[model samples]
Target: MKNIVAAVLAGVLSLSLTGCSVFQTLEGQTEDKPNEYSNVYELSSGKAYVWEHDGETDIRNDLSQDRVGDPVFFACPLGDINFKGDELSDIDQYPRSIWIPSDIDDQIPTVTSKNALIYISDTTVPEEIIFERFADYGYSIGVSNMEADGGGHYFITYAETDEDDYKYYVDMKSEAAQVTEFDTIARLYLDKVGGMEVNEDTVSDGGTVMNLEKDKSYICEFYTGTFYQDFKLKANIHSFGKLERFVCHDYEFLHANCIKIEIPDWFKSGYYFVQGVGLFRYVTDEDLLSYNGKAFDPGINWNDPIKQYDEYGVCIFDPSLDIDYEDIENISDPGLDESEIVIGASPEEEEETEGSEIDESSEGSTLDSDSN
Candidate 1:
């Protein structure tokens, strides 16, 4: 009787050890399974390509110059810019005004043909900085040379917002827009800030670029205004530091729909956004000549030919050759994969074990028959 009892106990112990070994082997197989995600690079002929790198995928249009996206229409800080004739009246004292010439003098430093318009603003900026209105092009260009003190400064320009056709963009801020169709070259000036967002907390005071990490620089800032009267969007831009084929490469342009403020009311200002490039503090009129290195013409026409091209000799406003902007979806963030590990026995395995019937060929069945 003692030997039979020892044999039964030893058989049961061996089966238990075998079951644990099988479970461990199954777990090890699961852990060795290949990851589902893999790197994929798909090129659509030569126009565009989808590249997956380090678990992240990016889709870019290789030929993004043939088409231009429509501009976001926000009210200019000057409200509706009016053409107040050629001269500034001594009696009419406005806060901010500038004389933009349709015909300028190369030597006289004045409007030669007396074909000038006065652009007056009431909402933003000091008298030192003025916005030149390009009537034919239907936009305003502003520049500043002020330092970024505690209050901050900005240089920004945009298309006309008061036109009845663009009433849709009057109140839009921080919204996504689709480029349904290809636009003309004339539309480039109007398409300054595409898909841009400016919140009330936008920081204006430019931070130190040296303190920033590699390949990073200050873009723009949105901060609460002085006396809490208004919110400010200050953009510090530098243009053409590097010569490149595309104007987009000259400066880091942001695309977002703004919120709260209709126009960026720059108080303390520096830098300027114009001709698809951000100008630094000390920009002269000669610096605003042609896109490529055209000699400075003092009599440069503000609206002679609205279209500007890059050094690559391609139209700046041109969109991609094959793909449309509507088809390209905006991907703000990348999706991350998650995994879970199970310990001991899984719930399903435990349930199966609890409900399992005794096997007739097993030692347990033999032990039961012997007992009987």
Candidate 2:
């Protein structure tokens, strides 16, 4: 009876070990499959391509003009505009193509030129469904400046349709290095503006607010860069709870050509604490009080009331400034105090003023105050 009992115990132990081994093997296999399909391709032009499979067919071919199942590539023309297909070292490298899922109900990729619009129908489905339905179809897509971070990578997809209208979609995947870099720059700017404590862990939410402001600024800056010609940041003040504002001045030769942007109020002030002291301190802290011969008064209000004339348009403050309710009534139509105004003098002007022993007060008030 004792021998029989020992035999039963040993048999049970052997079965348990086998079950443990099988479980581990299956888990490892599942993990390995996804990694196997993942690929990263680097082109000669300092651009990188990263992709993961959704269980679709993997084939490489050049169909540049055909527009059927051919891979499409997108990039910013700020740098090089040429595509060097021969320099790409990957054996599977192929010209970029537009990707279309076979199962999409619309049978066509949604496209839009408006930067504010988002395409959702194709991206919301399961990866397997997207692959089985769309990837099997010959729709190759092209995207530019794709960014990824903790949230995910986003790429704008553009496809040429039979109707000559280009369809746009945003393709998302795992966050990559490029997205992280932009996030870092944005966080740094927020730290400068709001003194917010941001690190990798808290960045997603904290960085999002900063990103929206920066994106708006970026758009405004881009427009300024293109249309306003030679505009530069003059005085920028960000306050808590809808009291944020920034000013830009355009210069031509030795005169102030125009005042470009005047953000009246910032909307995200309630989310963070921005004291008037911060803005005053920033000016004094940066020692911007003395640019050329002119000095700025940190105690006075920074809002400009003069509606100056410029060739392109009336130089007035941005209407968004009305969002700040605290001092909105007081600043509704504030005028520029010429005594408090500071004109940036050139190096030559500085040298001339220094040589002549002129009084600093007289030089400070020489800024042109004519509204025209």
Candidate 3:
């Protein structure tokens, strides 16, 4: 009886080992599956080809014949328009905001004059769906100018929250969008923290690249505001003693609808926090140039916006020798990671006559982090 029992136990152990081996083999295969990242416009042939490297063969021939059972990610074309000029705005196409990482492959260009509004295929979905996929995957974006990599490795980092077994995150693919000859040469949008001024004494929520890690040298690219208020943090970039690269920017970003806030008239004496809003976008030349003389409007389209950054319009502060928000590049600041980061806004501007002032927006909205 003892011998029989030993044999059964051994058999069971063998099966368990075999199962584990099989499972590992399957996982490895899935992980190694030609992990390709391409912009929606790059799939010129209107199909996802077997892309391998930066320069893959044409995608038209890459249609998987046997893999028809697999789910193919397709970008839906919405608010279609065929632009016919050199300059194209959402006025001629979909009027919403799109953010791309700073260290994106130059091969994979940002919204340029060529393919801003162009979509690869007709099958596309709304930006909301894309954002949902990003949140569900717990994707975290990072920007750091690693002292290594021979300088210029300042990458718009992408990774999953799961450090142990990170399976998925946002992998850019072809998506349908309006296409036309007119191209959007450049793009501007608001994110977490955009205000009229950023005082020198104010600490960033990781919005400026120089403010990213406390250890790096402080060249001070965009954080040049002093005195009172009305400056906000912009993009983060990598600087190895060279011209900075534009990585990403933080503007006040909110999804869907915001909760209503009604300030109590009787409660305007001391410190009162407004839960509904936060910083405003920094005023720029583009804003003052608008036909309507209003500073940038901090509003949302609810569902569909009308033009480029129509919701997060540019600010109206008059320009000076001071560095504007767009001047900041790919330097990342931990403080500005979330768009809901708040600023201290007093009805009156702080005194910049001395130097930079601290973020003492006492009457401004307190950090209503819960609203986020």
Candidate 4:
């Protein structure tokens, strides 16, 4: 059976921590939190979660559930995978809502309209992640942006036909581009890519197919709304792998299900997905050909394309063990200048220990990270 509804996307950004033990539960990390976002922080195997803010739509309210599963833990596969977290001082440094593996069960505190109470766990529950036709998949409300010059970039969704309609879609005369809002651009792109008149109230469900059965192929229209881009992809689930654990970097995701999707015999690229986590891994025939001693890109003649699908495979987060932060500040002060704030270390402590040797970074550090 298929369920249809409006869906949202929340991109996953892995956090970089030093050598830390796997899966460290933060007991009192939220003790000093002042708001719901800070107070309800969770510690899980997720390194870090990065997402964009869409309109006032709360994804949890509009989540489509074909089965009695936890839709609140939905994840999207588009965001700044390159997002760098300077320090883990403030819990609000990340997205409003997050999913963390936990053993605690209780009524969650109410978050503001701008915040979401989305949480997830790696525990394998009886409910399955069902993919339906026209239903809105749950993830945090991720928003995308269209450049002022009519240039649009998307990840999860690609154009079905190579039409130069992007120039026609944009109104160069207006100060704000014709495709300003995320939904407007998303629908327009979806109409072209998914080959459906998304503007129309009723859409034709001609090629929509999704049962999520292993080794079974199904043609489906997948929609993605992430921080950088919001669009749809029309592809076939070539095969569904058995539910297993997906370990990336220092974090491990339990009950991780894999789905192999492709664009039939045309595109030579492969997209992979996890049940709870959206698109986690991707592969390409070009890289495969090059790995097998074939010229992948003749122009560039790039042989070692960073990854050859064998060394570590395609996991979302980079396996490097380095901490990175970019213009990080307290969530409350948006205009505050970026400072070098370390987790569990105050300004005075940082200054005092500037030249002194400190202990190594570990999972049991100050603040734990979360995923979408």
| TM-score of every prediction relative to native | 0.14, 0.14, 0.21, 0.17
Candidate with more favorable, higher TM-score: 3 or 4: 3
Q: Write the per-residue lDDT of candidate 3 for residues 1-372, one digit (tens) a residue.
A: 999999988877787877755455566874323212333223433322222222324333223222232322222211111121311121312111112322331122111111111122244322210110000000012221111123322211122232311111111221101111112211111122233222222322122232233122222221111212122222322111111011111112112111111121111111110110100111123333331322112231111111111111222111222223343232223243334211221112123411232344532335554345
lDDT of 3: 0.22
Best by lDDT: 4
lDDT of 2 by residue, 37-154 (tens): 1111211222211211223322122111222332232111111111223222222122221221222212111111110101112122212100000011111111122223354422
User: After best superposition, candidate 1 residue 317: deviation in angstroms?
Assistant: 47
The superposed Cα distance between candidate 3 and the true structure at residue 184, in angstroms, equals 45
TM-score of 2: 0.14
Best by TM-score: 3
Off by over 4 Å in 4: 1-178, 181-269, 284-372
lDDT of 1 by residue, 243-275 (tens): 111112111111211111111221111121122
Question: RMSD per prediction, one decimal?
Answer: 37.1, 26.4, 22.6, 28.1
TM-score of 3: 0.21
In angstroms, the error of model 2 at 313 is 19
Worst 10 residues of 1 by lDDT: 237-246
